[model samples]
Target: MTVIENIVGRVTVLRGGRYSVEVDVITSSGFGRFAAPVDENPDLYIAEAHRAVSEVDEIIGPELIGFDATEQELIDSYLWEIDGTEDFSHIGANTALAVSVATAKAAASEKNLPLYTYLGGTFTTELPVPILEFASDSEFDYYVMVRDLMEITDVVDAVNGVLSNLKEATVEGYSEATEKASSELGLDVALGLAQKAPMDMEKLLTLVEDNNVAYLKPMGDEELFLELIAGTHGVFIDGEYLFRQKDILDRRYYNALSIKPINLGTLTDLYNLINDAKSERIVPILAEARFESSDEALAHMAVGFRCPAVVLRKDSIAKLNELIRIAEDLGERGRVITFEG
Candidate 1:
């Protein structure tokens, strides 16, 4: 009978020094690696990491060591049971997600096939358009290295560049720092905003209109979140930033759903959210589901959902390469994506 041979957990820092929980699972046939998301607050994240590490070593490791790894339903049910809380506060959502994903990865690794294939990936040639981000000429130039950039504005000549529009591009102090970088390059690229600060509708709408912001990732109350940016270019619901599930009950309010698997607390919840969004014609974004390692990447990718886009951070080749590899494995060579820092 296939069983978990051993489990190991470690706390590591992700890009920008965010703490994360990394987990590894080994079975007779293969191995798996996964990690939990981190918090920006160092102290809070470190505490969560320590808790996860302790749980794995003292409690979780013993309970599931002899359990069959292939039996996903059984394992996940156990995960739900252990957590008790709907949001997985007890067992730590990050730990639970890491384990669930690692188990799936181990099973796939044993087969020696792509994780997407193992998780029912359909072979298709259709490619999703990728949205590339630009900060400077150097950043823009590097977009081609990624192999699937749609909005790479690396071809800016000095004359046609921002010189003529220098006054417009080089504003005194742009509220949106992201826009400042790309806008300075004078590329015909659209800008997006994450309104972390609260604002009235008039002010928010005017900001969107004046800046010609292409999308809004609002962070605040449900009513205000929707009010500030809905029906604009596109409204993407970022639970990490926005933090309300009930806010998305209405289908017409927003057209895109973005999430991290860790934030959802379980694979089941993540899939349910994706399916619901798809049914309602809302774009399902596997965006910001930051799987730091290859195993986490495959486990999440193998769910067999061809998303509208998956956001990739522009920090490391490892991250970008992993994303590209997942897309290729799923026969989705060009998954729609927007670059973020």
Candidate 2:
């Protein structure tokens, strides 16, 4: 048996070409803290589990042995089959969660950041504590995890379920399927924004009354505000409001603001417009840029570069940083600096 199993704790290869993996602490101290029964021979249990998995592997591994592990859905099919077998739900769930988490960790490692950083939010502080609520599930394409606390009771289970479901959904183009479910359930869904700085709990509740807002974001400082706007997609700026658009929003790409100067499109006019927007604390998202010496001209061109002139509400620093990051990432030729109050 040319077993190529690597050591990552419970990752193991047993005879009959079976593989079993577990993500659990095998230490006595961990068992002591739990009220559950502790196995004196955890190794033996692990071994038996692997043997069982190997037997099942003989039946399924051939179909998948040389397949991609990074393609989790493909890997999950066999696991799902194992789950359907007699007395395998707990093991299957545990195995799947561990494997899924490992895959996520690996991806994050490739990006050289923590998993939450990969999700969003800067690694400037500790991870925000997520709020947990236990209600009958409804139809929201996305659920925003709110609160700044490290942990809240009651929500742990739901969060895991949502995360797991989200991963699977992402792998499968879950939007189409969810849309079908929403139609069948007759759920009236809408998308909107929530202001959540210093945790605006009441405002969030109020915004949700309409249920039209899909994304509720806290308006941070200048930098953060800009970042948030950069993050939003599918809505283009129209005058002062974000008008809905049919195109999918790409969080990665930059959108430009359009400038109008009495039908004269000159470099001087462009610079002035871009500068004016910046002077007013509006970080203009520019498209179609070329090098220009004057900061004034560069700034003006930035403003009138695109639709709706998406600007952050002043004093949102985190948002300002985010916006600056977006511009910088898109190779805008200006260095971001804070204005003194």
Name the best candidate (by lDDT): 1
Estimated TM-score per prediction? 0.73, 0.24
Q: Give one digit per residue, the lDDT tens place, for model 1 in 172-199.
A: 1222333343456544334444454556
Off by over 4 Å in 2: 1-65, 82-91, 117-127, 130-341
| Root-mean-square deviation of Cα positions for candidate 2 versus the true structure, in angstroms | 22.5
Q: Give the CA lDDT, 0 to 100, for residue 156 in model 1.
A: 24
For residues 84-136, write the lDDT of model 2, one tens digit per residue. 65423434432443333343334344445533343333422221111121111
Residue 221, model 2, lDDT: 33
Off by over 4 Å in 1: 45-48, 124-188, 220-247, 289-303, 327-341
Measured by TM-score, how close is model 1 to the native structure?
Answer: 0.73
Error of 1 at 29 (Å): 1.3
